[model samples]
Target: MDERLETLAQRTGQWLRTHGWRLATAESCTGGWIAETVTAIAGSSDWFDCGWVTYSNAAKARQLDVPATLIDAQGAVSEAVVAAMVRGALARSDAQVALAVSGIAGPTGGSPGKPVGTVCFAWGGPGAAVRTQTCRFAGDREQVRRQSVIHALEGLLQADTTAKSVP
Candidate 1:
């Protein structure tokens, strides 16, 4: 794991512990990389809830309830799909925070618009707080996946922090 990712995970774990929140994940291109990184810490079991690797579109629909029609219309690596993934993970788990990712992290899956390294991320919680982003990173397969995981952690940290500041 990158040092930055480790730091972000540490911060996220600390914040979740402070705020009495747990986290879940729904992953596609990065596999379970985000969950793996989160669980790397010794006591992460307290804050880390669960993770689902829904790589295939069918799996996304079956596991995370991502709509088949949405995947068919917008493909798997889109904001709508990732948002649905996050919402589904949040709904299924007892977690108060959720991160979801879908992407084309490869040399082959490049189309004109949605090229490789195009990753979509979504973070949501119990309240009306949901955020999403689309990042076009520059790297190989592993590099892109790693970057995606780091960004997901960063987003979680940001969300957790903002949620805390809300009076």
Candidate 2:
């Protein structure tokens, strides 16, 4: 695991604990790495709700309720799909904050438009709030996934901090 990611996860877990918010994750290519990183912290169970590894299109639809039509149209790696995944995770769990990821972190799943290191992420909470990002990383499968997890944790920390400062 990246030391930077570990630091981000520690900060995010502590921030969530401070704000009295819990988190859940819905993952595809990264396969729950974000969740694992957050839970790596001691007492994370206080702020970690659950995680779903929806690797397949069908599993995304079934587990996270990612719409079948959306996956068919967007191919499971688009901003729309990941936003839906985050919404679904928030809906299914007791967590107030959620992060979701879907991507092609591979040496074989590359396409002309969506390449091997393309990853999409979404983070949000209940009510009218959500944010999404897409990045074209450059690395092997493990590196890309690690980067994605780091970005996910960073986003969560940012969101938590911003929410706290709002009021």
TM-score of 1: 0.92
On the 0 to 100 scale, the lDDT of residue 132 in model 2 is 82
RMSD values for the candidates in order, in angstroms, are 3.7, 3.9
Model 1: runs farther than 4 Å from truth? 159-167
List model 1 lDDT by residue over 53-151, tens digit each. 999999999998989999999889988888889888988999999989999999789899998999988888767556777899998998999999988
Tell me the lDDT of model 2 at 108. 84
Q: What TM-score would each prediction reach against the true structure?
A: 0.92, 0.91
TM-score of 2: 0.91
- Each model's lDDT comes to 0.87, 0.85
Show the colliding residue pairs in model 1: none
For model 1 the local lDDT of residue 2 reads 69
- Model 1 RMSD in Å is 3.7
Report the Cα lDDT for candidate 1: 0.87
